[model samples]
Target: MRNIPTRHTAGRTIGGAVAALSLITLTACGGDSGSESTGAAEKLGENEGEVSILAWPGYVEDGSTDPEVDWVSGFEKETGCQVTSKVYGTSDEAFNLAKSGEYDVVAASGDLTLRMIAAGQAAEVNTDLIPNYEGIYDFLKDREWNTVDEKNYGIPHGYGANLLMYNTKDVTPAPTSWKAVFEDAPKHKGQVTAYDSPIYIADAAVYLMAHQPDLGIENPYSLDEKQLAAAVDLLKAQRTSVGEYWSDYTKTQASFETGDTVVGTTWQVIANLIDPKKAPVEAILPSEGATGWNDTWMISSKSKSPNCAYAWLNHISDPEVNAQATEYFGEAPNSDKACEFASEGHCETFHAGDEEYAKKIWFWNTPINDCLDGRTDVECTDYQDWTKAWAEIKG
Candidate 1:
């Protein structure tokens, strides 16, 4: 019942409704708030009996997907908050669904969280209500995507980086950089695979950041039109050698196992799933670093069960539960303590709580016109532009 990470889909337009949402200046710590006047709950009320949740698949389990993978039941049992959950495939889908105001809580990736905030769908969270928040890694807290104007919008969930994965048997002269999938891709023509998302463009930008310093690409998410064009050009060139553009976990695993794909961008989870006997593979955060995701759990502005929603957040952040959830999803736990409850060697495998290694990743952030890298001289292209460019790259 393992599932792939929920990612944005290419060519899916961010319609006028979403595009028209107010644009907020994204800052490293706390900057300004352009979002609607929605404040965090001052205190929790009695249990609301039931709380609805919208999240990525495998995030909220009740022993339904797999009898052993049940996290919701315990929350319901302990808090008296009956948990009703819905799963979303992509960030766009989650954004639209969250706008309905039906679900009390929604688990969103970095790309979707800001949009929810701008649209007045997400409420600023009073992290004080959730004691477990203190145990979370400081690096994962109060980021631009999940926090605005010094307000907390949600709790950090799990995070993992997009890595350079290559078959040891087919890819010789071990790849220490992403050049294997960008510049040197043609060498393994028709055998290289890349992530099937516009966000994948950031992977190329990461490479340029290290190898093509002349481009001045400060942040992968904040790309000007020219910078985006450069990334598009690199991806377009890599496209010729790409055997398949993959988002589905099974397909990519199969390709690597059968030798159809020898090199590409992959999640550590996908690399772990591959059978070493059939396809010896290694996944690494290349020297150039990588694009990754740090999902957040935010409450809805119109939530009917605010107390229950807050309770759920606290329950999930417990070291034991956090360990179960993150390990099951194959990402780094948010805290060092959670590592203790996780399977032996799990933290080492994912590098949980390693701040130095964490710094190496440019966690996915929504691209906006106001450059996230603090460049005011030029406007950066937004996700909409990236979507259109992705279509062009694929074609």
Candidate 2:
């Protein structure tokens, strides 16, 4: 989510095929922080030759005139590697593109990372190659989505929560529950919008998990027929109140600008940076508790240039790189040193260096039920099953 796309807010950049919009909310303002000292970045080693990257649109600076906000040139300059980038709207698209064996690395979200690893499209990361990797937090290092056993697959990236952001000017008291976009949305009638991605079906799943705890909806990704039915039912009700499904940042920003929807579930990064010239909106972390996500760099297992890829990962997650990403993306940095280079107030505003808040954030861990915590009876749903439930909800 953070800067990786959608800042994990409502799975904004998960790809239109999977969710709704292609969110690139990871700019300095896209999150809570903006600029930092890459002086240390100069110390990180260089990348050799050209590294092809399949990236989400806003992951790196796009040669925009805004030098104040650029990651590519700096990266290339620091690494000494030439760069060629192709932008895709969804993880599915990136996966398909990456599957072609064209790129060296991918900035994958939790939902898609495991699939990439399983397919052997991404190689397991050798921590020895990435000296800075030791800085990654322990919990993230071995998770259902990234690693198997003690092996690592990719580097820690950015993370953020899916908050219930809305046009407070229109929503009156504002919303405190997922029901605002589920069962209760109808009262608002044509003023509701849910995430526009297939994986977003998980948002509905998360709601059911909290509100219908009895369902034992432990893992949104792994739903049984009964749990799937409930999630779909809730979504169908939400769809009725929905005016439109959004998967593009420009579209959501525009929708809010036109006052098409008063309130809806959204990402913090996108919600915070909505083009104010277009609309006045506010983001709220609702009380029923909310679901969130994270984005990370998953290396291609078959990458011809694992060296360059590792180099890229090391450079990106370096404290300075991580800090820059956090400031621009408005999410928490996964790097310990990166926070030191972050803007003065960024630690508070974006949770940049706050371990306490970081602990509280339910960064979207790819849902698995073996139980991921340890259980004999439940196994998580595979992508195909989640895919099916997603389609049913859309229907």
Candidate 3:
């Protein structure tokens, strides 16, 4: 979700954890070790005096937005390393920026983390260097997007789901499935909305997996040409009723307020921001489930201040620190300990630690020709295919 201003970029260089275990798919393509190496540090050393970071706007706040929203100051004070940071609006933007090797670390969404690893822009993180690592959620550890070839590349930060949000007054009978926005979308006619990104195609694939089981779509991110075409067809139909596609959180909330959009997909953060007294809207995870995000904090392979970078990683993963970060960013924290640090009801509201709820979410991962689900019988379409298909659906 675009919770902050468009092009909201900033920087902090600091010195940074070990934390816990989780079971999940490993989605990154670990190119051979022979792939270009930016010099992954063999061991941690003295604070390098400074560290640089690239992240989503709200992910790296130093109290600039609100004085109380500062996580960076404490890290700098404890490590004696100054912090500098740059924030990006989208995963694609973050991926490109990381490639420049200008930052020591990055908070990458699942969609970009694996791609960065495959491109060798990020390196395998030495988990032993992070003492706070033991605090992370077991389900998030060694996941496909954050680990490659059984090697951990980064730490699982926080996560949230894309929910089906609707104006309670207008969307009758309370929608329970994705069909409300797909097959039955016309009933809302010109009032439906959706996320404006190529990754959204996975949402359509998700719907097909349930409504048309014959498609044999096990993983929404792993789609062959035939399956992809089917998903694109469904989205193309949805395009007709889409009043507007959105990435900006404020714009989406505004649309709901004005009743320009009655039903569509949304982030939990957006749902929280909308004044229910005025908009009377509610968000739900439809029966077909939803596409979500599991962001990771990865160190750059070419980091000039590797020690400081590791320092920052460890600092952020601390239970108190992780709580502050996830709360500000509007997602469930990675550590069970973070739950104690959160405000009353915050953890329950986001379904924190609910393994069953997590199982329902198809976290975002970049599509690749080699099926991510381990199906060797067919070559699935890659991210480039999704991009092209998105354009056609939009047109």
Candidate 4:
């Protein structure tokens, strides 16, 4: 649902050229990169030129040789466009570098998509160039942040839950709520780890949405003054249980494997990483529906090889590519077709393709006034308040 922190925590996303995974298409213009019409079709031809991509670790890396994952070659072969990527450690990193217009495209998160579009850091995508976008779920179609006035900027990628994972062999009566790592976490002590970001404030906010209805909280990110205070106070109260705030996926896996932690927030991929036989780990949705995020692929307004980028976008959406991404990346494919080719035990074992199951689960969308519950009157507290509250909660 969020990012797996890497070197990008250093503040910039543009790094060395390493081959990695590819991404998707677009919609509206929130801000102007040029005076071009958002509706105009920009042909991304395979000029056999080069394009740069700013993305996450596993998206393009194949783990074949040096950097571990090697997906860049396939994209190059298929499109004849050379790809060079800077694998980001955090969304903030990509957002910053992308703002410079130095790179072509980015794998943006829901939280930053709007910020990027507003800043004119990314280009509004022409859906006509990327036909596969039509397959994206309507839920992601056009929204306030990624799209402005019905125009799109990002191609819907994939997503999974930020679950409470545990060492199944050791933990019994499996913990079901965020409380296992927050409220009742004292017993776990050194074994507990939490997400190392202000964004995690949303976890507490979501919990409040489910348990503290009297608080009158709606969107976890859209906290009013009183609502923000409550979320911060709840986290500050639960701070003692937070032993570590994890930012790296490899380290997170190590924490569980070493039995250093019994329960904490983690992505679904972490569950698959735990040895099913040795140390069993499970992704608990919790009794209350959980908060999560979807990874989206958005085109760069300045991409020289925009055509090749669009090709990669559609390629990843294909059922086979989507299935491959799931097996290797450890997240569910957003495309319905991709879920059809879910890896072994993925569909039956995890309901990987169950539309009914997905509906029952709340996918994280960027918080906006067309509130998740659909009340248009409430105003979400600005981001500054969220920041101040995050510091107080984690302090």
Candidate 5:
């Protein structure tokens, strides 16, 4: 049976105050702010009998939330690793919690993975020890966010796109592009919604990359001042039409149901939750492509249960387990095999294992002064800039 629709908060923005403080701290100490952790394990040892996990809500279910929704119990029963899991509301919170060295493992979104690695919170993951890792999609392996300098840092979990969701009865001709929310937003004035976060700036950047080739925007997350300004302009214009900018899933669902929102950016899970009888809606990955997130399960650098951590990683990656966890959280499973174990039509709904579709997504990444797109000549805007810009755009 499908689990209840719980909002999965992985890639949402870190609060402005927290972001400003983090940026100041990173700058004061330079980018290399934390000690590097020891390398990946060369061999496994006996189970440590316990493991603590920091993860997004619903990612590490032990039936505490709902008796029928759980995958952790089996892992504990089989591996003898009593699981204690904490759910984090955002990547920044996960980063702070993981740094406490209180977690043996962390399910990190791309935006938080590199930060964790930089802060000495993530240990290199030895995929050889995770046999199920071989089954994960190739496109997900060694990505910029989860890997640094060709060394893996974590196992791929699941992913989902920030899709364009619109009221079917209200939207005409079946919108296939993000233009509906950008240039055409005025048509749905006072009814269009958008994600409320700085990372969402990347969505505008993605739209710009396709419509304005002269911007030379190779990566949405790596925008220079001019490119960022162009995106900011687009967003500022869009803000005029936006009914509400949302970080809460239930609010978006309710808005759509009540006809307060006719068109806007949304997640597939929210689309699933809307009562079709109240408001007909459809969510699609627009033709211009989209921004999304791929979360990873990383072993903690200061893990007190390294053996159990490895066991938990491998256990969770098993196709059936991965399916249960990802489906519950409403995202594409990481591997083709995992799709088979997912509920009927779930894989198709999320486009699991579709490498071509995956290519169109620029997964969430922490914007830094050093361009993620590899342009050394010009400095790109960092998360701090994005944070400040987001406030300006929203205002």
Candidate 6:
């Protein structure tokens, strides 16, 4: 949901190491090397008897959240790898916490994955080692966001789009574009809300890309200073109408139900949690496209329990486990077979196999000086710049 800042923002480090990596039945294409532990473990050595995980809420459940929702217990019984978990609210917090070397694995959203790679916090994943890897959706594998130069980093967990949601009664005419929250923001005045993170800047950039073609913004995350300034300006104006900015998932839903927020950005999960009886609402992906996230379970490069980490990866990727996690988290699962394990029509609800539908959503990616949109001529503002700009906008 957020990323990159000043304090620990060190320059990228280069390393060399090819590990014996395989995905499902694929042959090992790389060899193990020291100094750089390829994100994969060479063999399923003995389970370390325990593993620690850093994940988003609802990803790793031992039924503590809901006794009926415990999947971690089954994994532990089968593999003898006890699990200890810490949940993070934002991608930025996950990225920072992963650096502390306390967790063996992390469920990283797309926005923070590459930054983790650049910082050497993530290892190259060898998919062959994962027994359930073959069942993953073909569309999620070997993609630029989770792979580097043809090597996989980790297994994709799930994905969903950030949709426009509004009070069905208060907001007339059923809004269909992000303009309701940007250009027409004043209309909602003090009743509008937005995701509270620097990443929300990309929402403005998405709006500008459609309305201001002269800005030449190809990718929301690849904005240069001029383009970023334009986005920031738009946000500064919209800030005037915003009732609150949300990062805490529960707070977002509570604000909507209480009528403090009438319109703004939201995830399908939050929309589901809101009681329609209390506040009738509707959500949709606007014509201008929307920002979204694709999360992956990446093992920590410094993990002392590689075997247990790999075991956890495989266990979570299993169709049943995948189904439990994705459904609870309110997103599409990464494994194609997970649908069979989901509730009736759950897969259809998220458009799990509709590649065409996915094309309309721009998944989050960390902003860097080297433009991801492929423009070398103009130097783009990095995440640190976004952090500084965000502070100014919030002020």
- Of candidates 3 and 2, the better by TM-score: 3
Distance from true location, Cα of 47 in model 3, Å: 1.7
Runs off by more than 4 Å, candidate 4: 2-40, 46-48, 62-70, 143-145, 276-278, 348-350, 360-362, 365-379
Q: Candidate 5: where are CA atoms >4 Å away?
A: 1-32
Task: Report clash pairs, candidate 1.
Answer: none
- Measured over all alpha carbons after superposition, the RMSD of each candidate to the real structure, in angstroms, is 6.5, 9.6, 7.7, 8.5, 6.7, 7.4
TM-score, one value per model: 0.89, 0.82, 0.89, 0.82, 0.88, 0.90
Clash count for candidate 2 is: 32
- 10 residues in a row with least lDDT, candidate 3: 10-19
Residue-wise C-alpha lDDT for candidate 6, range 257-360, written one tens digit per residue: 99999999999988889999888999898998888888889988888888899999999999999999899999998866899999998888888867777777
User: Candidate 3: what lDDT?
Assistant: 0.80
Give, for candidate 4, the lowest lDDT window spanning 10 residues: 15-24
Give one digit per residue, the lDDT tens place, for model 4 in 1-395.
Answer: 52213212211111100000001111122233443232324675544466677876777654454453445677677767677778776665676677566666678776667556554565667777776777766654554335554567777777666788887766667777777766777778778787766667778877888788998864565566677788888878777776677778778888788778778888877777776665678877776556566667776665556666677677666666666665576776666666667666664544554554454344443333223333346645544455566677777
Clashes within 3 Å, all models in order? 0, 32, 33, 18, 0, 8
CA lDDT scores, all candidates in order:
0.82, 0.63, 0.80, 0.62, 0.82, 0.80
Output the better candidate (2/6) by lDDT: 6
Error of 3 at 149 (Å): 0.5
Candidates sorted by TM-score, best first: 6, 3, 1, 5, 4, 2
Question: Residue by residue across 359-395, what tens digits does model 2's lDDT show?
Answer: 4344544433233323346544445555666677778
